[model samples]
Structure formats: C-alpha cells, structure tokens
Target: MTKLKVAVIGCGSIAKHRHIPEYAAQDNVELVAFCDIVAERAQSFANQYGAKAYTSYEQLLQEADIDAVSVCTPNALHAPISIAALEAGKHVLCEKPMATSSEEADAMIAAVEKSGKKLMIAHNQRFVASHVKARQIIASGELGRIYSFRSAFGHGGPEGWSADGANSWFFKKELAFIGAMGDLGVHKTDLLRYLLGEEFVEVAAFVEQAAKENSTVDDSAVCILKSASGIIGTLAASWAYNGSEDNSTVFYAEKGILRLEDDPDYSLIIDYKNGNSERHSLGAIQSNEEGKQTTSHVIEQFIGSIVEDTTPPICGQEGKKSLQVILAALASHDTKQIVRV
Candidate 1:
C-alpha cells in the first residue's frame, strides 16, 4: 500500500492536538510537511513528527509531495487555504465553519469540482458515538417524528483552547469573522442537520458579545432554527458558560425525549412517553478541557474517503449546507428578523 503523504497548514491548537497526532497515528498516512507563519512552531512539529517544516503554505504546497492537507487555520483562512490545496491536487480536510460567508464556501466547492479531489470538512461532532447512534435511531423511526430540539456548545472561551491564550485570533473579528457562533454554534448546526437528516431553512438569533473581555466578535448567541420539515428548535453557542463545558442536545419527539451528552455518566438517554427510560454508555464527546484527549474519527474518515476513492461523509456540499445556517443566524441577529437560510 502506498502511504498517502499529508501536510498540515497552520500549526495551531487544532493542528497540534488533533490533525498532526491523528494523521501520525494512521498507518496509511505519512506526515510529510508542516506549515505555520511561525517557523519555530512548524519546525517543532516537523522535528517531532519527522516531517519538513515550511513557514509559507505556498512553499509547502509547492515543495512537499503530499496527497492531502489539513487546513486548521483560523476561520477566515479556511476557504482560501482549502481551495488552494484542492487546486494543488491535494485532498483537503478543512476545519469547520467552512468559510466566513456563503460565497466563500461556494468558491471552495467549485474548487473541489474543478480539481477532482476530495474536500472534507472536519465537523468532528458528527463522528461522536452518541451523535451517530442518535442519527441511526432517528433514521430507524424509533424517535417517532422529532418535534423540536435544543443543542448547545459552550465553554469558558477560546483563550483556553487556542495557541495564544487570552490574545488568540479567535477574539479578533478580522481573524475569526464571528466568534461563538462560528466557533461553537457551527458545530451544532452541522450535528443537528446530520442527526435529524434535515436542513435548517430559517433562523432568528440574538448574537452578542456578552462576555469575554477584549473580544470584537460575539461571545454568546442563542438562535431559533426551523428545519425544512417544520421542526423548530434552539441552538445556543456561548463562551460564557464559566463552568465545565456544556456540549449537549435534547430532542423532543412524539415518542419521547432523546438527551445527548447531557449526563456525564451516560452519553445518551431516552425517556419514553410511556414511562420507560433507556441509558446508553457511549464514549465521551471530544473536548478542549485539560486531560480530556478524546479521539476524533475525522482524520480516519478523511483518509478512508481518499484511499477508497469515494466521497467523504462530510463533503464540501454538506459543509456548505451547514454553513448556510450560521450565515443566516448572523444575518438574523443583525437585522433583528427571521432570515431564510
């Protein structure tokens, strides 16, 4: 088997913790190059992983004999970098919130079409055991028509997760584009879409910089989303949770309520309308919290898609659909009206 040579752009927290390590663990992947604006960071990862380092992504793409690349940069760079990688005949595993705008996301999809290479968005939440199980159960019609749902992803802030604490690019509007909604909300948007197998057609949201000092983008947001099938729900993304991370979701169905990641003991819980309850012990959801190094199946799936010459589970088109909701939410917040996605 010829190993797929992979390069990583942006040696930031996501690259260091998830992309690099995960790629290295794949037997069919060769970590061929690392790129970062900070040469030292790139060089350090290169030394650790036995790959060359480049300060310029252009140079890395030009020089490395790579089959794939992971764009783990800030939200603003996701589209441009992913497009460039695709044009260079490299498969792309771009971190989520695909791009800053729908146009940018479209451009990425167009690039994939032109390049004939795979482009997978790293929406790792969909790979969570509980989320996958929920999707399976929903598809099985065991939930009996989900009427509504509430999904949330909240933490103290990105300061604790980014490479630069308190002064991270995540706090800057220019670099991050949007804050909590882009950072956390987008994950739920993708997850909800995947879980219900439905699209969010409308959104009304209140996005505010409620907490986190020295931030130009939103620190808290609550969005009301209506799916195409008329299922309505709330999606909240916050950097103001202040306590242990609250990444959980609950679906109110005709049969019962399905709670995901709400309880530490059990990852999924289902309460039937007929007075019966079931608890599932799926593994923990991935977190940025210290000492919680849960595995994300994103890299494995991306590599598998490329090796098998098949479309990724979360392809460019799927990513664009999920991003539409976030873009609509932002517009809804700004206009103070319901926005069609």
Candidate 2:
C-alpha cells in the first residue's frame, strides 16, 4: 500500500494537539511536511516528526511531497488554504467555521469542484459517540418530533489554548471575524443541523463582547433559530463560561427530553413522557481542557473517504450549509431583527 503523504499547516495548539498527532497515528498516512508563519515553531515539529518544514504554505504546497494537507490555522485562513491545497491537487481537512464568509466558502466549493479533490470540514462534534447516538435516536422518530432544542458550547477564552495566549488571533476581529460566535457557536450550529437533519430558515441573536479585557471580538451570543420543520430553539456560545467547559445540548420533544453531554457519569439521558428515564454511558467529547484528549475520528474518516474514493462525511457543501446559518445569526445580531437563511 502506498501511504498517503500528509502535511499540516499552522503549528499552533490545534495542529500540535490534534492534526499532527492524529495523522502520525494513521497507518496509511505519512507526515511529510509542517508549515507555520513562525519558523521556529514549524521547525520544532518537523524535527520531532522527521518531516520537512516551511514558513509559507505556498512554498510548502509546491515543495513538499504530500497527498493531503490539514488547514489548522486561524479561522480566517481556512478557506484560502483549503482552496490552495485543492488547486494543488491535494486533499484537505480544514478546521471549522470553514471560512469567514459565505462568499469565501463558495469559492472553496468551486475549488474542490474544479480540482476534483476531496475537502472535509473538521466538525468533530458530529463524530462524538453520544452525538452520533443522539442523531440515530432522533432519526428513528424515538423522540417523536423535535419541538425545540438548546445547545451551548462554552469555555474560558482561547488564551489558555492558543500559541499566543491573550495575544492570540482569536481576540482580534480581523483574524477571527467573530469571537465566540465563530469559535464555539459554529460547532453548535453544525451539530444542530446534523441532529435535526434539517435546514434553519430564520434567526435572531444577541452577539456581545463581555468577558475578556482588550478583546475586540464578541465573547458571547444567544441565538433563537427557527428550522424549516417549524422547530424553534436557542443556541448559546460563549467565552464567558470561565469556570469549566460546558458542551451540552437538550432536546425537547413530544416523547421526552434528550440531554447530551450534560452528565459526566452518563453522557446521554432520556426522560420519557411516561415518567420513566434511561441513561447512556457513551464515551466523552474532545475538549481543549488539559488532559482532555480523546480521538474525534475526524482524521480517520477524512483518510477513509480519500482511500475509498467516497464523498467525505462532512463535505465542503455540507460545511457551507452550516456556515450560512452562522452568517444569518450575525446579520440578526447586527440588525436587531430576525434574519432569513
């Protein structure tokens, strides 16, 4: 078997903790190159992994002997880098909030279409054990129609996780575009779409900057979404939850309520309308917190899709649909009125 040579862009926290290590662990994948704006950071990883390093992704794409690349840079760089890799005839596994704007996301889709290469968005929440089980239960109609849901993903700001602490690009509006809304909010948006398997039509939200000092981007947002199926709910994403991370979602339905990641002992809990309850002990969700290092299976799926010549589970098109909702939420927040997706 010819191993797929893989390269990782950005030597930051995400690349350091997830992309690089995951790619190395794959039997059919070889770590060929590493790129980072900072020469030292890139060289450090390349030396550790016995791969070549480049400061510019353009140079890396042209010089490296690789079959695919992972765009683990800041939120703003996702689209451009993915498009570049696709055009260069290499597959891409891009980190989420896939792009800053719908226009950029569309261009990325166009690049994939033209290049005939695969592009998968790293929305790992969908691959979580409990999240996958929740989707199955909802699809089985076991929930008896999801009337509403509230999903929230919150944590202390990225200062503790990024390569540059408080001075991280996450707090800057130019590189991040939107703060919590882009970081944690987009994950819930994608997960909601995955669980409900429906598109949202309208949104109204309050995007605010409240917690971190000297931060230009919003630290929190509360959005009410109305789906095409007439289901409505609130989605909250925040950096203000400075205590401990909260990655939980609750679904209110005719049959009962399904609580996901709400309990440490039981990851999924179902409360039946007949005054009965069931609890499930599915595995944990990946977290940025120290020692929270469970495999999300995103890299495995991406590699499998390529090796098998199958469409990626979360393809560029699917990612675009989720990004559209986040764009709508931003409009609703700015106009102080409901916006259509």
Candidate 3:
C-alpha cells in the first residue's frame, strides 16, 4: 500500500495534539515534513518524526513530495496557504474558521475547483459519536419540529492550548480576525448546521471583549440565529468559561428536548414530551486539561476523502456557509440589528 505522504504547516499546539498525532496513527498516511515561521519549532517536530523541516511553507510546498498538507495556521492564513497548497497539487485539510471572511472562503473554493483537489475544513464536532447519533435521531423525525435551540462552545481560552501561550495568535485581532467567536463559536455553529440539516438565514448578536484585558479581540459573544426552516436559537462562545469547558447544545422540538455534551456522564440526553427519557454515554470529547487526543474524527475523515476520491464532508462551500453565520453575527453586533446571512 502506498501511504499518503503528508506535511503539516504551522507546528503549533493544534498540530502537536491533533493533526500530527492523528496523521501518524493512520495506516494509510505518513507524515513527511513540518513547517513553521519559527525554524526551531518546525525542526523539533521534524526531528521527532524523522522528516525534514522548513521555516517557510512555500519551500515545503515547492520541494516536498507530499500528497496533502494540513493548514493549521492562524485564521487569516487559512485561505491563502490552503489555496497555495491546492494550486501546488496537494489536498488540504484546513483548521476551522476556514477564513476570516466569506470572500476568502469563496476564493478557496475557487482554488479547489481549479485544482481538482480535496479541501476539508476541520469541524470535528460533526464526527462526535453522540452528535452523529443525535443527527440520526433528528433526521428520523423523532424530535419532530425543532422550534428553538442553544448551542455553546466555551473554555478558559487558548492560553494553555496554544504554542505561543499568552501571546497566541488567537488573542490577536489581525491574526485571529475574531477571538472567542472564531475559536469556539464556529465549531458550534457548524455542528448545529449539521445536526439540524439547515442553513441559518439571519442573526442578531452582542460581542464583547470581557475576559482578557490585554488582548485585541473579543472574549465573549452571544448570538440569536434563525434557520431557513424557522428554527430559532442562541449560540454562545466565550473564553471566560473558567473551571471547565462547556461544549454543549440543546434543541427544543415538538416531541422532545435533545441535549448533547451537557452532562459529563451522558454525552446525549433526550427527554420526550411523553415523560420518557433516554441517555447515552458515548465517551467524552477531546479535552485540553485531560490530554485526550480526540473523539474528533476530523483527520480520519479528511484522509478517507483523499483515499476514496470523495468530496470532503465539510467542503469549502459548507465551511463558507457556516462562516457566513459568524460573519453575519459580527455584523449584527456592529450594527445592533438583525443581519441576514
């Protein structure tokens, strides 16, 4: 079997914990190179993996004989770097908040079309077992009409999880584009879209920099979103969620209430209108403090798409749509009015 030769761009904590580790575990893949603006960082990962390192991503793309690359760079770089890799005849699996804006995402999609290579956004929440099962239940019409929902993704912030720690790009407005909204909000919004099987059409929001005093980005945001099918909901993202993470969503439907990632013991819980209840302990999600690698099958799915010659589950178009929800919410915050997606 000819294993897929892969290179990782941006040897950050995300690469250290998720992308590189996952790629190394895959039987059909071999990590071939590592790249970072900081030569020492890239060289460290390369030495550990027994592959070459490059201080510049352009050099890696031009010289490495790799089949694909994982764009684990900052929010602003996702588009340009992924497009460069795609244009260089390499498949790309980019991190979330696919781009800072919809226009950049469109450019990425255009590049994908021109290159005829796969481009997948790493929205791993879709692959969580509980989320997968919840989608199945919702698709089965068991929950009936989803009237309202609350989706949240929050944590203490990226300080501990980022390679740069306190000075991580996640806290910078120029590099991150948006703070908590870009880091945590995109995940829930993307997951909500997948679970409900619909697009959000409008949003109203309040975004603020309430947590980190020195950062140039907002640390908290709350948005009210309405879906195409008339499902209204609240989406919250924050870096102020001290103590423990809250990555959960609850849906209120005609027949029942479905909650996911709410309870530590049960990942999913359904309470029927008939007074019956069901619970599922589908294992815990990947955690930073606990050092859990993943319940996130993002890498597996990305690799599978390349090997099988299938469209990525979270393609650029899908990622763009999810991103538009966040973009609309940002506009809503600035204008103090409902923005249409």
Per-residue lDDT of model 2, residues 1-341, tens digit only: 89999999988998988988888889999998999999999999999989999999999999998999999988989998999999999999999889999899999999999999999999999999999999999999998988999999999889998999999999998889989988888889999999999999999999999898999899999999999989999999999897989999999999999999999899999999999999999878899988888887999999999999999999999999988888998899889999999
Q: Distance (Å) between predicted and true CA of 296, model 1?
A: 0.6
| Residue 300 of model 3, lDDT score | 91
Q: After superposition, which runs of candidate 1 have C-alpha atoms over 4 Å from their true positions? A: none
| TM values, all candidates | 0.99, 0.99, 0.98
The Cα local distance difference test for each model comes to 0.93, 0.93, 0.93
| Candidate 3: clashing pairs of residues | none
After superposition on all C-alphas, the RMSD of every candidate to the true structure, in Å, is: 0.8, 0.8, 0.9
Candidate 3 RMSD to the correct structure? 0.9
TM for candidate 1 is 0.99
What would the per-residue lDDT of candidate 1 be over residues 1-341, giving only the tens digit for each residue? Answer: 79999999999999988998898899999998999998899999899888899988888888899999999898899999999899999999999889999899999999999999999999999999999999999999997998999999999998888998899999999989999999999999999999998898999999999788888999999999999999999999999999999999999999999999999999999999999999999988999988887889999999999988999999989999988899998899889999999
lDDT, candidate 2, at 185: 89
Segments of candidate 2 deviating more than 4 angstroms = none
